[model samples]
Target chain A: MRHSSGFRAFRAIGLLVFAAYFFIPLLAMFDFSTQVRGSAEGRTWDNWAFMVTDEDLRSSIVASLLLAVFTVVLMVVLLVPTMVWVRLRVPRARALIEFLCLLPLTIPALVIVVGITNVYSWVTYLLGDSALVLTFAYVVLVLPYSYRAIDASLSGIDAATLSEAARSLGAGWFTVIVRIIMPNITGGILGAAFIAVALVLGEYVFASLLHFDTLPVAMAALYKSNGPAAMAAALASMILVAVLLVGLTFLSRDRHKQGASS
Target chain B: MVGAFQDENGALTLGNLDALTSEAALTALKGSLILSASTAIIGALLGALLAYLIVSMPPQSLMRRSTLAVSGVLAQFGGVVLAFAWIATIGPVGVLTKAMDDLVGANIYGSGWLFGLPGLVVVYCYFQIPLMVIVFAPAFEGLRPQWREAAVNLGASTWDYWRHVALPLLLPAFLGALLLLFANAFAAYATAAVLVSQGQPIVPLMIRQAITSEVLLGQANVGFALALEMIVVVTLVMVAYNVLLRRTARWMR
Candidate 1:
């Protein structure tokens, strides 16, 4: 095949434009965050420091991190057993299970918040007024992404065969699931956890509208009082999420390599 | 959704459905439709082009892998951080706005349009384009090189190969991805809610207003109606998307 200079130039120019479109806003976030308040020149680290020093911001960050942890825990505990049970016993329900898992993707979170007032009232009554109750909604929010990730890895390994082998050896159901199949799908579990954390951390709609002061909601509030500090927090969280998601690709790629080699 | 049909006393009624046809609700729906459609269209075209350009690189190259990884991150990027990022770029106190004023004496930040519908489109594209790339890139990769080689060997030029072979093959996947982007933008709330603080220019923002401040005690049902409307629109788009995906899958294998 012969390469044409014109085609190569087009590719280069196209890539450059895409790069600029993506990177400029991110760069501007950093630039805007460091700009000194009420000054035409120079920079200050005060805004960056506010991420930790501000009381409301600090508590919100903690709340969000805890929410991410709880969501991951709940998603794994709730989904893994049901999914494995379906594969082992009731294969007839696979379509229904798949549909239900993917249903949240179609029913936007905004809709859930709007329609969930009655359910949340019961939840708040039982769980008190803590923001951590958002873990339930976050689990539902991350369902489609986590389900796809976990399902892919589950399919990669022969779950039924592994469970059957363990069963024949006189192992109990708990051990078969927790000790055998669970270890085999560690990569998928981790991928799911990473994605859940990323989504939970960045989530704003449910938390904001529901009157919870999570990290993103706090950032919005902070944006009004202090613009530079809000930009600083926004840039910081964006960097963290980018790192986790980019790391996710490398993690999955390494798993693929390990699978091939073994 | 059942709540949308119920009145304040918890009795079922059709009054809330009537709220959807009100002047305010109609305008908000129109704004949402315009925003989602424009962003989806522009995002699809640009994202498909960018995906093709990236796919032209060596499959395992570091640049290619990083670009794909970055695209994955950006496609999922939304919410307050994204809104703030745009503000930092072209908002009133944005860095570029100041830089442009200093260098060329041109004020790009005219009357704070970054907080309006046009601003929403540009900001929405920040995530929409990357989403299009993530969903559409695999289709481009699935284009077996042998097909292209076969086309070229059969007395076909590059233009002929793309027009006759690639374009038709990619049409279903492209349309599916476009619908996915539309549903994505339509259901989005965080960015719009954060950007447009005053007016309820879109359905999601209107829902927020309806929930927060009620003219009557049970006026919040209007928010229910609006949310139901969003779900209906998004569900339709996603169903069409799934049908296109199934068609694309038949040949992709």
Candidate 2:
């Protein structure tokens, strides 16, 4: 297709408009965080210092890390076996299983919190309000992304052939799955885990509803009370997420290369 | 009912599981569906338009690459920050609202749709467009150059080419993207809660209310039921999209 100058000019204008729209808010956030306390004085590092020094903020960061790790672990434990089983034993139902796994993606976080709270209120009530319930909801929240990554990896492997080979070698179903299939799809599992960690870390609605103080919720609370400190937290979060996104992109690139080589 | 399991000391009991389907639970379920479906439809339409504009542009352009990158970032940057931005832009004391009120005698700030369904839709669109672009870009790339040339060579007008050749090829991808947009919009909570009026209860807001209420005071079971209902509806929509994808897989080629 040939490009025209008119189209080129239009593209430039569109790009500029969209770029400004996207960056202005981010700039505003930066400005809010850096401006001197209470006055329009020039930028300072006070907000960052405050965000780091606050015990509650520090605790929320630790809590977020814990929650994310738990969510990632739970997701892998729940999704990998179910996905492998569906792929190997119930191939025809792969579509159905995939649908069920991704079902959480359709639910709003608040709604899931609502459902889980209702279904597990007795559990929460009994446990005296532990973070366990929030962890379960986070598991559901990351299910779709984890399932997609795992399912895609499963599709790349010849599950039937691998299972057959393992069985002929006198391996039990559990052993074949544990020693053979899992080691093969480690990349996908890792990729999914990374993505799951990011999602769980960023999740706010579920944690807030469940009364757990995850990072995002904590940041939001701080933003309401003290805007500058919240901006520092937000910047920290953005940096963390950017690193994870880069890692995922690299994993995806490696996967592509592996696919091509095979 | 689930609360029934909580003893004086807040311990769990098997008996509390039965509270998952109470009257309050049913109401929350209904509210989630209505809110999710409404937001999904609105978001899907706006997202489709944004995706179309992005994809329809010429290749190798800076605009295309930047749009792609920015959309990727914005799509992920939702929640409280997004809510704050929207308020900054159009809330009662917001720049846009104040300007409009001063210039046109229109009080669009706190009095009108800006704080209600309209505001929700606007916030939903902010996230939805980028998502749609992500999903639709590849679908658009799948369009064969020869098809467009063939349409032109056959004396078809631009409109005819788009209607007859492009739309058919893009329908499956569009539907898939729409399903995703629906899911994202339906599940969204914080943006709406922050931007919209508290009096107008969306399912998420309602759930939050129930959860935050005094122990043994609010209808938490109903909130759970509402969440369940949302899950079911989103599941059904996804299944339907998958079926459509399978059926149209050949056609998309």
lDDT of 2 at B141: 76
- The C-alpha stretches of model 2 lying farther than 4 A from their native spots are A90-96, A122-133, A163-179, B1-70, B85-116, B171-176, B214-218, B221-247
DockQ comparisons of all candidates to the true complex: 0.67, 0.26
Q: What's model 1's overall lDDT?
A: 0.89
Sliding window of 10 residues with minimal summed lDDT for model 1 chain B: B3-12
For B11-122, candidate 2 gives per-residue lDDT tens digits of 2132333454666555655655555566666656655656656776766666665567656656776776676665655655554665688899787665656666656766
In model 2, residue pairs whose N, Cα or C atoms come closer than 3 Å (at least 3 residues apart or on different chains), thus clashing, are A108-B187, A114-B224, A115-B224, A125-B10, A126-B11, A126-B12, B25-B222
Record all residue pairs in model 1 with backbone atoms less than 3 Å apart, i.e. clashing. none
Model 1: share of native contacts present?
A: 0.84
lDDT (Cα, tens digit) per residue for candidate 1, span B1-253: 3343243325215468888899999999999999999999999999998899888888878888888899999988999999999998998878789899999989999998889999999999999998988889999999999998999899999899999999999999999999988999998999999999888889999989888784657767777778778877987898798899899998789
Per-residue lDDT of B137 in model 1:
91
Reference-based lDDT, each prediction: 0.89, 0.70
**How many residue pairs clash (N, CA or C atoms closer than 3 angstroms) in each of the candidate models, in the order given?**
0, 7
